[model samples]
Target: MIKYHVRKDQAITEVKVSGHANYAKHGEDIVCAAVSTATILTYNALERMGFKDNLNVSVSDGFFHLEVLKPNEFLGYLLDNLEDTLHQLELQYPKYIKYQKEG
Candidate 1:
């Protein structure tokens, strides 16, 4: 199963994603692929928008952690998109994924 946590506070949003869905073999798991695609898209967008100075990130096999140190309205909106995507996935595949959001 894959588990992720999102934290939102004033001027900050931290997201951590870890583990594989294991819905199928590692290379052929659609659940994992879907999550990866969504996460990568968010990460890329943050980078392209020049949030590098206000962010901390770590990416590796089956893990991604993004910390938004100085979130603004735009960044918050973008991160909300990410949360929505993950929430949809969690709802669709309750057996394979879990999501938690906190403040």
Candidate 2:
């Protein structure tokens, strides 16, 4: 599994991607789906923290993008949300991947 943490301003989002990088089309497709789901989870968390609606989310060409209406005000909140999310994900999917961040 390859994992990374993306921080925009102060908002930190952890992305852990696992699966066969070199495999059949179907396997790659599944990995894409997993990545997309993780992205949605991040986006929704930001929304819950009062991020304004700016652009509709779209996952295509193996990329995910989200427009944050206010980066300054929402940064800390977003990172906090990400931390909580990672914790939950660890609990829910213990066998998938673990979030390794030093607090």
Candidate 3:
């Protein structure tokens, strides 16, 4: 299954995502592909918008993590968009993905 957790604290908002949906074979797993595409694009968009310093991100085999070093009014919108997208996916594919948000 694919899993993601969002944690928020006084100074930072952290997002951790890992695992494959395993809903299909590697190249054909649309769930995995959708997650990857959304994640990478969010990272790139933040960098393009000149907020790289305001955030930290890590990616590795089957995992992607993001930390908002500090919150910004605009950045929150983007982050929320990402979360909302994933939440929709989780709703539709409950057996393949899980999402949790906590303080």
Candidate 4:
């Protein structure tokens, strides 16, 4: 299963995603592919929005972590959108994805 954890601070937001959705074989797992695509797209969007200087991103097999070092309105919006998308995925693949929010 994939576990997504979101954290919010006064002016920073951190997202941590880990684990693989063992719903199917490696390349055949739609859940894993969806999660990976969404995460990479969000990271690219952040860079395109010029927030790369204030962001920290890490990725490895079955793991991804993103930290917004300085939060702004646009960053908040992006994070919110990411959270919503992850939540929607969780709703559909409850056994394969899990999401949690923290402050």
Candidate 5:
């Protein structure tokens, strides 16, 4: 299972997505959604790039989770998109900084 916690202006959102393989013989299947509007923008950009080929997107103002059958390239695509989306979002809300702290 993957979980994401998104906060803005005192509003907090939590999102979780997970998947389990039927058996080791079968491949792992999974998809994750974020609890941020930035995530929706990322999804749209991905779709514009001809991705989201089999992905499903769902949302609500407070929280939302999308489910999709994991695809061969989805994970890499998701990572790249998230980075890009947050970069753009930061530009608009520069006061809110986001960075991964190295441990």
Candidate 6:
């Protein structure tokens, strides 16, 4: 299963995604693919918007972590989009994906 954890602190947000959905074979897992794409795109988008200095991102097999050191409205919007997407996926694949929020 994939476990997604989100944390909020003042004007910062941190997201940690780990594990595999295992809904299908490696290359055939749509859930995993979607999550991976969303994370990568979010990180890239933030960097492109001049948030590179305020962001920290790490990606590895079955793991991804992103920290927004100084989040703004746009950053929050992006994170909200990501959370919503993951929640939607979780609804469809309850046994393979889960989400949690913390402060």
Q: Model 1, 1-103: lDDT tens per residue?
A: 8899988676338889999999999789999999999999988898899877888999999999999877778888888888889889999999999985544
Worst 10 residues of 1 by lDDT: 6-15
Clashing pairs in 5: none
Whole-model lDDT, model 3 = 0.86
TM-score of 2: 0.39
Q: How big is the positional error of residue 13 in model 5, measured in Å on the Cα after superposition?
A: 19
Write candidate 3's Cα lDDT for 1-103 as tens digits: 9999977564338778899999999899999999888888988998999999998899997999999986987887778788888888999899998985554
Better of 1 and 6 by lDDT: 1
User: Considering every candidate listed, which one attains the maximal lDDT?
Assistant: 4
lDDT of 1 at 4: 91
Query: What value does the lDDT take at residue 8 in candidate 5?
Result: 24
Query: How are the candidates ranked when ordered by lDDT, highest leading?
Result: 4, 1, 6, 3, 2, 5
Off by over 4 Å in 2: 1-7, 12-24, 27-30, 48-50, 54-58, 72-103
Q: How does each model score on lDDT? A: 0.87, 0.48, 0.86, 0.88, 0.42, 0.86
**Candidates' RMSD to native:** 2.0, 6.4, 2.1, 2.0, 15.3, 1.9
lDDT tens per residue, model 2, 1-103? 3232443444533333334222236545443345446666766776676563543444444445454444454555554665565456556554543544434
For each candidate, what TM-score against the reference?
0.91, 0.39, 0.91, 0.91, 0.38, 0.90
> Which residue window of length 10 is worst by lDDT in model 4?
6-15
Using TM-score as the yardstick, the better of models 1 and 6 is 1
Model 3 worst lDDT run, 10 consecutive residues: 6-15
